[model samples]
Target chain A: MSNGIRVAALEDIPEGEGIVIDKSVTGTADDIALLRDTDGSVWALDDTCTHEDASLAEGWVEDGYVECPLHASRFCLKSGEVQNLPATRSTCPHRVEVRDGEVYLFPNETP
Target chain B: MDADISRVVVVGGGIAGVSTVAALRAGGFDGDLTLVDTGEFPYDRPPLSKEYLAGRRDLKQIALRTPQWYDQQDVRLVNLTAVTALRPAEGAVELAGGRLLPADRVVLATGGGAARPPIPGSDGERVHVLREAEDADRLRTVLVPGARLLVVGAGLIGAEVASTAVDLGCEVVLADPVNPPLAAAVGIDLAAWLHGQHAARGIAVVPAGVESFEPTAAGIAARFSSGHEPRVFDAAVLGVGMVPQTALAVAAGLETERGIVVDTCQVTSNPAVLAVGDSARTRRDGLLLPRTEHWEAAQQDAARAAATLLGRPAPPATAPWFWTDRHGRHVEAVGRMAEADQVVIRGSFDDPAFSVFGLRAGLVVAAAAVDDPTAVRAARRMIDRRVRIDPARLEDPSVNLRALLR
Candidate 1:
């Protein structure tokens, strides 16, 4: 059931930004935040910030982490571990593969 | 100095103290670590005035760390106990039961108590103060529907409680001497806009301080400093300020002015005893800087204290930032906006989300945002890195903040 679904082209996510894929597409509990780090690596985390009601998709991606746009709480893109205060819980990170400039998401599967 | 370290005792279980232990472990400090706290568990305080006060969250929900954390970290958790003395000479801390825990380093995170201004009848049963979870529990009981609540001081805590109380169906009247509160922190223009939000959301905002309080059969009568007619309310909340719990430090002979005087490394006057959080104040060049009383400040202090304990280089310093949720608005401010020569509004006030950037010497010095945390976060980097940017580009919402950093 955890098939790698093509979500978006790699270029769709700009460096240092994120895009939210609706939970409907991923069949996950929450929408997924597709992040493109400044270093050009792609990562996926649950869209909602663990500390509050906020979209991680709207966060700033830099230095391999996504900062929650609500309170500046940051999460490691690779591990989804919180790197900031006011947020102690980590978001769920999913496996993603980039092939031929296209992003394939393995929903509910950790990378 | 680092070679001799073995045992470390952290007093208090608030964010500051808890994070101290957290940072110490994160920094690879495997020595004997003991945390003495009066509470059963370390919990976050910001929620005390908002979510906890509204009965939306519980004690466990606000706990800073899981119960297994202390055990996993191999740090001794002495819960429901107070540290009565800091015996630097004996190299230990005296707990309430008279047990002295050995310590090579002692960290004081005693936090503070909500200040109850010197107003007659201010200590009445109806008067409330939000600091500890117990205080929130007491205040929440009276926040029933149609309860007349008088929230004094329109600062962060006061404003937050007023917002929470109002949301709980209490008729809130927020009184403060300042016309628009938090002007120094968020700037006058933004302060006015923020304070105006109270009225827009059905809270009564008064530009006056409390002269006195008189408890009567009907309720408590509060006379405003503005000399207006005295008003009666079912309950009163004193949010004027906080009184640092410095008695312990003072009794221990730690140099304390307004707060425990600590150096840049979070070391107190006594090298063996260090302090952090609200109860600790930083002194540099024989000058004591203001005590940072926010949650993030406490955490930052803990990290710094941990670094000192581990004898490691300090983490990269960043611009200070804090957030407050009031009246359903998530507001955040970073840096010293009062020092800014100019304030630039990034978006229209009428917009759903906007930010005000304070600029000085062609650089962003501070920023406050309404429903716009990204702007504040970006502004924080600009302030910390001292990035020069065009005001026009900053003012334009279309300009990506990341580009401004370049």
Candidate 2:
């Protein structure tokens, strides 16, 4: 059995923006960001930046990369690869699938 | 392309050192990495002056990386081992423990040490200079509520400590030789405004140089050059400044000015050695930025230096950036304002959020935003591209700085 959970609705998150979904899967304060790219593609990643303890939900998303609001470190929303300095570690990329206009997240393995 | 670049030695286990090691691993550099430090562990330094002093944060939370993370990253941690000298000719460092670690490449991230004033009795138990984690831990126990805290120097650290003391309900007195804080970095007008802001917060801003401090039964008494006005205080904090640890670089025959002189790639005079963080004095377009002590600058410099070591072209230097938090208010600034000819103010001064733009030769060279992250973000981009916006538009609070970049 897969340990996946329904996080948010597609309508709740607009296109070309990110919405932070708070969940209790992780003992720590875990926040997941649902981002919609310019090409209408959606991606999910951990809201806490791996470099510093900054919130990625406050970051600016553009061209499939979410720039950390604190230091402007860019991270690829899909692969979670940190594209810039200051933040060299990649954020935990969550597996997301749209089922009946609702987004379900698999919180176990981070890509 | 890998031409035998294996061993990488990082000196100094502060934020810059740990970040360098992490960045190298993340950048796909599978080298024999060794991190040497005099300190027991890698910890955050910024909090030493603020949260740590206020007894709000514990030592465990400030550790940059857990011991397990170092092992997982394949990093060799040499703790409590001080590097006495650097032999750049042989690409090796001499540790005080009588060990020589040879490396294909070396990174000097030794950071900076606190600068103590020449005044007598400056090193007493009642007086303290904050730099390391232990320093803050020891100082926090003494900075009790209702204590008379006399803080010398009005720089970023000085001001932050003063603000923290005030928040803790301590009687804080701020003294500096200069009339206004940051007058040397920022202009007099801005510094004066900052002084006024601090004064409004009920802190006594004493504009006098310290002659000496005498220990009394109640506390320490600070004597200033302007007629000795003795004030008993439970504790005193010295946040004067920092001196770059460039002794190793100088001993290794590296070019030294105010700090270890480095190029855009953060490469010291010796091509095999690089300096990053506060210890590096990088030159850009003939201007020497001796002390870009901000955390962001250290991270960027470390990344650039790493790229240079890997034989990659480094990115162009962006505008200088720095931020400070005082009395729950966040102040962020970008670029060098010392060279600006025109100053533009946006938003009402009475409002909590406002900004000042510094323009030189019609270009937005620098900006300082108070409680205004939006304006700061815009100013960062404008400074990065060296873009010139209309002075009137810059002064208008409604004008989005981001649109100006567009």
Candidate 3:
């Protein structure tokens, strides 16, 4: 189920920043976390950390990796690969595009 | 004297030893690497007290890395073997099977063993010490529903085991010499709140010393120093911390006081020998830093030791940090909490989500948070960047913490 929907305005999230789109806005079953790296490249991933119930949106983003604030585990936002530990699994990555100054997120169907 | 540094041998198979080997390989070291560990596999120890002990996780799940990973890394893992002696002068380590392995450098991350105080019925079959996987497995058998468990000591281990036991539907009595343990680390007020959280979860907090344990008709009787009636328990877990394994270091004629003394580079007095983890104390210029047993400390030690061997500058020193999971709440504390001159409470303690940040001058020194990783994350950066913070703003949750960074 591709819930491809507009999540937030492009300017809403500054460069090298991230924003969390809760289920309320996305109309999806999961929270989508969108991050914009320093290069102005945007990526989308599951908001919940694979290790625990903490929100990946609450984590610190740096160099394309988002570090879970709970246990310091990090995940690559682009590929969803686990870059650090306490977290053995990777969060599901989603397809994203910025068009007409708006960010659109296509949630991972299998996530 | 570099002494033709080519081959390196690391003793002990815990995180420190394994991480050192991994770091060495990651740093593009193409030399012979050997690792000697007493355990069958180098598993993660933190899970032993929580998920693994609760039977929610298995040994394979806790293994730091797969066997194939070691092979890929070209690390010779000598499992189920002990380093009988260390001959630092000769750059060799004698194994339990009377084999001497030559090396240019040797790292002793022997770890430590659970401290078993002299208790009357400690020899009993039901008395358990949660250190190794075997200890957790034995304790798992008796942690059945409605079973009575006496956990001696209220430190991290005891409190964690007690939390796990409660989750297993066991009647847990956490006894300690002092009420609300870890006051020195988390402050007295917060410690009491944590103790109360355990009590609220139906864990009996016995703020008294366990005088002795005697075998009774039904189970083991734990007599307390508080003059209370002896309480019988189906099993007792000793969580009185660990004793550093330093016999081999002493036997090797290395200078040791409590643990193997090493410098900031993790190099022992004998240049060819190094020590890390729970069995190592950092010493420099006749002064010593207290040895730490936390998991992250071991990892940092391994990184520094590896950098030393690689002839590279040491990584930037970050504040020490540790976390604990108890009563379904994740509590994280970073840096030295005791060094704070002022304390700021962010969020109300009555609320489930709250944090306390300790500050020295205007900079954040340390922070302890319950279910609030955002605050702790900000606090860690503030401490690392040495960013000055306004105490009033810290207490006000409306003020963005990251903004204070700039």
Candidate 4:
């Protein structure tokens, strides 16, 4: 099961935005976020804000950055660099691949 | 003197001040450190509002560091001295006794004094604000069994005081302008839960603003803004709020907004000066976080500022955390959440051990746990890692949060 990637359909997420996929892994409690960018590109990152523990999913997505809802700190969707104060560290970004028109997100490993 | 080698003078002998000193020492700073306090001793402040009020702990137990620790750390302690004037550019501070101490660096740790609301005829022997040891001692005497106690403001401090009073078998009436206690900090729903807890424990909570107060034959009469009725009690404890001690910082030509304006590194407007604790307002994303007042934040801010001064990369902001104790139950909250978000409850709220997770935009933002330390600790990791969890899974008490990280 670990070797074969689980494919999530592209239609699962709306165009130009992201949605959290509710998939229960063997050891994880929460699901992962699958993002569909403006360019029809897919990127995956942690959905929670590193600072103050706000939700990144609720944050505003613009200019390839996600703005934290609570404090307005922005994090790059691609590189996950925190582009503002308050949140100094970058968020965890997962590897994404699209196979057979299906989106697959690898669990984030980099801290 | 070299620009890098600066003497920082921190005012206030409380937790914020000493914590800053400890941070500086831990940062490998060999610079001269001077800590001034009006009180003759250095002690923790939180207990002054709770355990100390209940006579469970004394001043010695609350002291953060002993005299020997100060000497070993090479920190100069100036007790019973009040800072009268701050001349920033001049690099000097004038004490009330007319002594001028020079400092290349200055830290305003002079936290704040408890605010006393204007209640006519409420002064004399029965009114007090528990900000100092003396205030707690005076209130302790009035906590005898069957003593009538009226506590104003249902804030964290006031609620704790009322809980202590109730535990001592005192007839306690908690009056507040808000509908329920802790509404300002947590929210109406959480506050209602807290209100129920207090009510079940026999505390009479009055959700009405005060109009006037007068000394009556029955002790004291309190008129409400509603004008519907008047209530009387034996004594009144005010827990309105704290007014930050920014006068010294302002006098020193430091920029002051709601608090002493500081950068991300905790550096004040004056480069040679830094502010921490309740007095410093840290600006992030154009908004000033005017001190979380959680003990951990103070220490972290001090450490970050000291490290920045020593030419190290600024440390990341500490995860916001705070805990409150009431009736043998520990309530802990982590992360920031808005009232508009969806709240998921894990386990039964009626149960002593339960946790509430706040979700927004399909992501977890904040969490509150009551006597659920394992859940609280797990939530802290998610908060630190910014992990998004399934709202349903988080609400399921059967799911262990620690396993979610893997």
DockQ top scorer: 1
Q: What's the CA error at residue B26 for candidate 1, in Å?
A: 1.0
Choose the strongest candidate by TM-score. Answer: 1
Candidate 3 lDDT over A1-111, as tens digits, reads: 543688889888865468899878766667888887656777888888876577777677767888887778888978888865567677788888888898888776432
Q: Each model: TM-score of chain B? A: 0.98, 0.93, 0.97, 0.94
lDDT of model 2 at position B309: 69
DockQ category of candidate 3 = acceptable
Worst 10 residues of 3 chain B by lDDT: B1-10
Per-residue lDDT, model 3, residue B210, is 84
RMSD to true structure for each model, in Å: 1.3, 4.0, 2.9, 12.1
Q: Tens-digit lDDT track for model 4 on B331-376?
A: 7777775532888888887776887777667666677777664565
Question: What ordering of candidates by lDDT runs from best to worst?
Answer: 1, 3, 2, 4
Better of 2 and 3 by DockQ: 3
Tens digits of per-residue lDDT, candidate 2, B1-406, equal 1567788899998777887887788778888999999887888777778777788877666677767888999999999899888876777888896789988888999998889868888878999888988778777777777888899988899899999889888889998878887765556666677777778889998888788888888788888878757677898888888889999988888988878899898888888888989888988787786668878788788778778767777767788777777777777778888888998989866786888888998988888877775576777778888787899999987875655776
Q: What is the lDDT of residue B323 in candidate 1?
A: 92
RMSD score of candidate 4 (Å): 12.1
Using DockQ as the yardstick, the better of models 1 and 3 is 1
Cα shift from native, residue A12, model 1 (Å): 2.4
lDDT of 1 at A98: 94
TM-score of each: 0.98, 0.85, 0.92, 0.75
TM-score, cand. 4? 0.75
Q: Could you give me the TM-score of model 2 versus the true structure?
A: 0.85
